[model samples]
Target chain A: MSDAATQPDSYPVTDRSRVKRLHERGRYDHAAVHAILDAAMVAHIAYVIDGQPFCTPTAFWREGTHLYWHGSAASRMLRAQKPGLPVCLTVTHLDSLVLARCGFNHSVDYRSAMCFGTAHIIEDLEAKARALDAMIDRFYPGRNAELRPSTAQEIKATMVVGMEIEEASAKIRSKGVGDEEEDYALPIYAARIPVTQVIGAPEPCPRLVDGVAFPEGLKGFTAGRRLDEVMVESHRTTFGVE
Target chain B: MSDAATQPDSYPVTDRSRVKRLHERGRYDHAAVHAILDAAMVAHIAYVIDGQPFCTPTAFWREGTHLYWHGSAASRMLRAQKPGLPVCLTVTHLDSLVLARCGFNHSVDYRSAMCFGTAHIIEDLEAKARALDAMIDRFYPGRNAELRPSTAQEIKATMVVGMEIEEASAKIRSKGVGDEEEDYALPIYAARIPVTQVIGAPEPCPRLVDGVAFPEGLKGFTAGRRLDEVMVESHRTTFGVE
Candidate 1:
């Protein structure tokens, strides 16, 4: 079976608790997990088809203990996820390139997290509606109540998948270049080139009508000050984020 | 069979022609994809494991024809990709989100790409060395040659997997908030809001040795003039920004 027919599942995350090297196997701790997840705006999900694997990425919202992922009802992933297949959900935020001393040693400084869990389909109309509202609320508040509810046909055409926290770990490397002790004295220059996400001046859509000022929600995207707040709030609901 | 038993030939990429969407999925035509992947520096890859699905994100590099991903020798993806497991790779970059006129109508504008391919393990010592070298060179031109070659023990312990693109597509959604046509003239402001990635002044590593000026490779990470180059380079690679 494939596509909407439902293919067999084939990917599993390594057991993090069994590993001794914390950096290699453990989640950085709660703060780090939240920080990394909050900093990210998207996620990549992977699954197998015919003994092969495929990864797909989409917008997501995290509220409390659950992560919500939604896409077209006809999406290959959506079809496969209907039974709540075991899925590996991962998120990464690249801080910068860690230019190390040696060829094999060259690495990047990044914040990434991986989790293993089974995603079950949310078939309830009320839950689906709430999930959609959560997504809307995260991207812009007041819109869920401000706008019309999803039509019955539209809801039926969309697919939403939900995954619990389950087993997960967040690992990070933020230091500068790492070279062997001997290479330290060499002519090499090693430093952490810091990188960050900064908001830019807003470019309103051309289709926006004249004389209408920016909404209070518009203040959210300014330099990402409110981004974390929004994301944290989004995670508060089962729908994840708007 | 597992990594210990499977040979490279066991994991052939099924149906290279299935990736026919490659041309239509070019990263440039889709502003959503361009913005998302450009803003995102990391991605997740998925594969099969004991009849389960798994996904993880590592640092990645994209040239014109290929997307390069590498990690430690013990990486599970490396072991799985050695046999050329059919894989779907995805990259997503998120810009300012759209808080549309309706709750269920809210959406995020993003840039994303997915490719189906078989990974051919670069097992030859020389080839493995070069692939690792090329990954390093992709970010820093002269640095790879500056480092020491991996010891035999290191090489043996390390696993390297390379995926050759067979088929791919880049999907995108950008501009502004998508709202119901009837609500367009209402008090609501519906339109696309732009988000940007800005490179700040390079903070040289504190350990950077004295007497050695910043390398030319670091030019792109520099403040001011170099920033534009970074964006242009990314655009060119993702969608031929020129």
Candidate 2:
């Protein structure tokens, strides 16, 4: 049921994707990279047009070694990227705020993945439609099947893009404050405040059709659940991975 | 005590920063752009190095029309950006998941600010030190002053960069699902699930000195409080702005 054993265990680290400064925190294993990517809902994609860099944040999902995202067919960013644009997609989960004894030591604990690849629009209609449904099911498993089928015009108005991960690295720092040994003795407070994205109560549309019940398959989105955890779980459930 | 009246009311909309797709959701006013930037902690800064774009997620703070972030002095990203690199800094808050009756209409409500500017390293020692402290105090208010002062070595090892906003725009979507008029009658579950980042209990460092109490000024970081709301409130309290 799983193709995990056949895949490469680690990404080939290139000069651009290598973690230079704090190399100890860098992980090139597919597990680390995939986990970070799967747990994140939004990724900031960086691409250059006319030597000017632009970072656009958009909802993205991962399937195997590929990442997918969509935008309006007419979006400037999407249009520019349709011709196989060199892009860097980055996902970061800010886990905690590390307040140290001094300003210099202040840092944030986060898990971040950066992937370098060329993104191209999915030109095939059948592939694009499947990718679109996969994205919806990625978050709300099984809900896509129950939703109203997409219209032909709707498919044409959306531009789905895919990027095969070329070189990727995950940088994670999850420990407590790392102040100097001397600074730890200073008469100052030091701690890590965990940061989390959580789901709140769902607000049903005021115009919901009668007898339409809340989608039970969206159990992963239950109120008060940590958003990242739920997303990782949903991805596992949908992909049939551990 | 506010300088609100003296500042420019809106950023000059540039060809690149203009929201071309959904023009109605675009905002150029200082209030809208600044509010979205202030409410978020992490900003993905994009810069091109040898024609390869990189999106780096970093903790950032906004003061007036300028933004600041810091990293290790020897970092590659910082080194490349020291020469006044053209960059885009984007901050996004995913507010809700809008599950509509069809895949085409499903979306995420978000408030995002994208700022185009040239980022340069802060060379002046005094200004860099002040900016570092300000970045710390931006989130924790008065906590920076109470913490142990930064050492000369610590200051030298850090690279602080600042960017004055050149062209900026805020794209916001806060409404519920916007499915087609006829699709609203479909027998499908549709709703907006609110998404929020919240703070958990602070975990004190195991090596903390005795009698050092949790900073009371961090009332904004109280457990269960929304992280974005607390950040905005902290910015207001620190900068004396509404």
Residue-pair clashes per prediction, in order, are 36, 0
Clashes of 2: 0
- Against the true structure, whose TM-score is highest? 2
lDDT score, candidate 1, position B209: 66
Off by over 4 Å in 1: A1-25, A28-32, A209-211, A223-242, B1-41, B62-67, B145-157, B224-242
Task: Give candidate 2 regions above 4 Å deviation.
Answer: A1-7, B1-7
Instruction: Give i-RMS (Å) per prediction.
Output: 3.0, 1.0
- Candidate 1 is graded, for docking, as acceptable
User: What's the CA error at residue B150 for candidate 2, in Å?
Assistant: 0.8
TM accuracy, model 2? 0.96
Query: How far in Å is the alpha carbon of A147 misplaced in model 2?
Result: 1.2
Q: In order, what DockQ does each candidate have?
A: 0.44, 0.82
Model 1: per-residue Cα lDDT over B96-214, one tens digit each? 66666655566666567676667667678887666666656555555555555567776666566666655555666664666667767666566555454445566655666688677
In model 1, the Cα lDDT at residue B155 comes to 63
TM-score for chain A, candidates 1 onward in order: 0.80, 0.95
